[model samples]
Target: MSLSEEPIAPTPTTQQDAPSGFEETESVNTSMQEFHQLYQKLLVITLVLTGIIFISVWIFYSLNTALNYLIGACTGVVYLKMLAKDVEQLGAEKNRLSKNRFALFVGLIVLATQWHDLHVLPIFLGFLTYKATLLVYTVQTAFISDS
Candidate 1:
């Protein structure tokens, strides 16, 4: 018989050689912990940036404008939290993102247009604070080395 015709015997695997359910669970738990930590860090950074900018705007601009900005900033925070929750649910509890968070922005814009005290410019700019935070964090992670 030729070498190609020879039957190959399967090597038996030991129980210790295979990954256990506990190990799989531990790895998943570790991944979730890391995700939560990243989410918390992003949230904290966004809040700090919002506070600093809000104070500066209040100092340089009118209280009405500051209040409008605050309203938008708070909405942005809520929208971000909702978005994060949706992201966490992706592939687990949800197949797609929820659009309810976007209603917050639309409501803010509609209110701004109808209200006498609120201006669209400041509110829109304030709403962009979250995007700025995400951009800065992306840049920081890309260029800065972790020690």
Candidate 2:
């Protein structure tokens, strides 16, 4: 066959040039819905555990308050684990939300210990770690958003 009889090459399209479609919007909406659901779940778990700790302290008054604080702290850890799982599933390239969640969790746990009049050095270290995480998250959010 002659060169003129050859099939023409398809034109290449740039990613920035692709037209927005229902698929893109739908996927974004689905991801946002998933994110909101996970956030609500984490909030509910934290609030419920906090309530349980309060009720246990008020009603029973049988256990050491440090132990009560520890129970709440452990529950907070489990809650973090749940959040981590969701973050992983979401495949988030940015971790602003996760870092804030962790920082708030650690701070609340420390305040709870203080409220119960407990002295646990290890918990302070955890707070420091959370603070570091918060710093990293802040930097990441700043740079990623600036792009």
- What are the models' TM-scores? 0.80, 0.37
lDDT of 1 by residue, 1-147 (tens): 999999997654864555688568787789888988888988888899889889999999888888788888888888889988988888778899989988999999999999998899889888888888899789889887663
Q: How many backbone clashes does candidate 2 have?
A: 0
Candidate 1: misplaced stretches above 4 Å?
A: 1-23
State the lDDT at 105 in candidate 1.
92
CA displacement after TM-score superposition, residue 39 of candidate 2 (Å)? 1.4
Give the alpha-carbon lDDT of every model. Answer: 0.85, 0.56
lDDT of 1 at 16: 59
TM-score, cand. 2: 0.37
Residue 79 lDDT in model 2? Answer: 50
Model 1, global lDDT: 0.85
